[model samples]
Target: MEHHIYIIPISTEKLEMTEDNHSMTNEFILIGFTDHPDMKTLLFVVFFGIYLVTMVGNLGLVALIYMERRLQTPMYIFLGNLALMDSCCSSAITPKMLQNFFSEDRRISLYECMAQFYFLCLAETTDCFLLAAMAYDRYVAICRPLQYHTLMSKTLCIQMTTGAYIAGHLHSIVQVGLLLRLTFCRSHQINHFFCDVLPLYRLSCVDPYINELMILILSGFVQIFSVTVVLISYFYILFTIFTMKSKEGRGKGLSTCASHFLSVSIFYGSLLFMYIRPNSFNEDDKDIPVAIFYTLVIPLLNPFIYSLRNKEVINVIKKL
Candidate 1:
């Protein structure tokens, strides 16, 4: 027997009703992977495995960093925060997505969707800032090795991490607050796997000009600022490495930056592709694969990238 998923649209008369009545009944049907019913089981198994790896790897990395006193440095601190963010980020989407694979109704309440979007925004934005912070730490360690300890003090590390979380919350609140103001009527069928900002914004019956502007300005600032910091840090690091007399110094510097650079490339590449455009311009069908990479795959890959590249994490794990 074949199972078919259906999304029943709200009637035009109902859409014309008052905001109060609409709010009471507002729900979104997520059109996630329904087009490929044949792959439901396969997708579920694949995503389930990815989700497991993401949870174990990220949470393990966090625990490892916290318990190992020798690994307690500015770099590892930022890495622990990254692992925490990745775990939270994957958790926000993967569980629901895996559930939807077997369930007939893929319906999510409006407020629930908003909550998911808020968390997603928080995690992703926090990650951007945290990566920038990591780059700065690397720069100080390599470029100013003599003064690294004094420059990247324990207090400063905590403050920077705290600042990243605060910035993330502020960005999420503004975006989600603006989202609440928009009226979502007509068709409540969200043409995506999850309740992303762009998909939700597309459902708005009212003009989402303010929301779009806010997304563009805020998201653009975070992305550009983070990338700029990382790039500039690497630029100086490269210069410093070239001027070094020893080949060992150059090799060590490149090895440290390579993993970070690879992770940054994957992250910012997907991020830029997804958000650096108007909502209307985004092709919903095309976005799923890209979204899966950042939201699901990246989390799974981060721990492997950091652990495989850094010997300290490996030694700590072996000791444990």
Candidate 2:
């Protein structure tokens, strides 16, 4: 038998690095919509239009809320925060996605990918709790109109908003920290457009058991908690509305709740569909369109949903 020896060269820097450390040189190839190369231009145009509309609509809403004195109520305050978060959430992913459409190099560095993932998570998590807060606000306003001012005071509103932001940061920190521990040795092609949690975890060479569990438990808790609050609030609101003797009062109350319910339904529906399941569901490319709807289309549609249904916003716009 002949003896064979194979010498594999290793860089000195790599040898010194620990298993937990990810190499800066590692790049992820986002194979986003590349299979439909023929539709690249069309997709670009469509997403670009969506991005433009999202920016103008969200920022415009924020500005309108700020400039108009009558719009400075607690409800409008929450609306402004939602607009800001929506703008940030869409911005964190859309610009890079648009660039990927035209660029031959779809490679994203490890740091950039992580940064994108972090901000996206922050905005999303914050929005979850923010929606809950908004629901609670509505509950107080509708169910206990006399006590609404006392229950949702300026101080309480600020505290709730602060808590939402803090919760978002903490959630992202834990998630991103877990993700950084895993090493990626397999192919770098991320099937999705952006650096989503499931796609990144699937690409890891390790078992990713802990990461997946954390996602399931933490994300499920947030989703369930938020949805519970919204449901409970709406239940009380509907009860209170029906008890009212005046038809005009009932119609007005329903009108307000309808817009909020619509917004909440659209947002939470897309989110749950994308994230409520295991990583096995991520393998399907069909999820990409759903992800786009969650991240981009929802943000774009939010302004229209709220503004079209809201006479206050319309009055403000007319005054401008």
Candidate 3:
């Protein structure tokens, strides 16, 4: 069997060019926070601060969920998983990103870059599912309060979390598998600090029709599926609120989904802006900033959102 490996046509002279030419052409430079050496310290400090906050916030949520049995409902269970996913996703990118910001090398080997992307995509996708799961849990608890326990049982909770991990990782495997079919050309400079699918796609010399289509379809589905879940859950929640004769009941109903509502808006808003629109409309400079909200800021915000909104979480935290 023969496989046609597509490649960019490098001129014979260019391929056999001087060492300097190859070094410049073959090198994959990372676009870190800044190119200036003096900026390294500033970037390191800023990113390091953000990274610390993310870790503390997520780890603390994990702890709160574990120690508080009273908080051991499907909502909190899914929240704990979301916290874990957020922490992992942030860790997957931020530490190396912060390091790259400071280091002189500022170049990741092709394999290393690919590996980073593999996990980054995996964790982020998992967060999407996890958040949706949290929404469903809220829906059951609020809209179907009488049957909440029966609907969101321990077994079902475990399966949803398990399914999310399974789904997210399976999604990633599909992408990495697709990438394996493509070949890397001499171009190695990754545009952003950490490896991302879009940058890698641009760098490939091969026809990426298959990979591009898969991403478009798969990403669209993840967006639509998760958003639909959130919307449907909230719609029922709103209907339940309308039916509630007690003002207290209605307030409680809306409050349960508020954090999730804010989170969904932020995450999906950026995603829709980035992937849902025309190809030529990309705000490339806004990529990192957009990434910051979902990747870094959202993780930091998770624990705060849950704790501030849920008296049980705050009370539990105070107890410890």
lDDT of each: 0.90, 0.88, 0.79
Regions more than 4 Å wrong, model 2: 1-25, 278-282
Off by over 4 Å in 3: 1-27, 35-38, 280-283
- Candidate 3 residues 1-320, lDDT tens each? 99999998877776667665555543467784664667787877877898898889888888878877888878788888888888888888888888776467777765666677778778778888988888888888887779987998999999999998998889988988898777667467766677777666777778788988898899889889999999998898889888999999888878877888988888788777666667712335666677767677777777788778888887777788
Report the number of backbone clashes for model 2: 0
Ranking by TM-score: 1, 2, 3
TM-score of 2: 0.91
Q: Report, for all candidates in order, the number of backbone clashes.
A: 0, 0, 3
What is the RMSD, in Å, between candidate 1 and the native fold over all Cα?
8.6
Error of 3 at 32 (Å): 2.9
**Which one wins on TM-score?**
1
Task: State, as a TM-score between 0 and 1, how close model 3 is to the true structure.
Answer: 0.88
Q: TM-score for all predictions? A: 0.92, 0.91, 0.88
After superposition, which runs of candidate 1 have C-alpha atoms over 4 Å from their true positions?
1-25, 278-282
At residue 100, give the lDDT of candidate 3: 78
Clashing pairs in 1: none
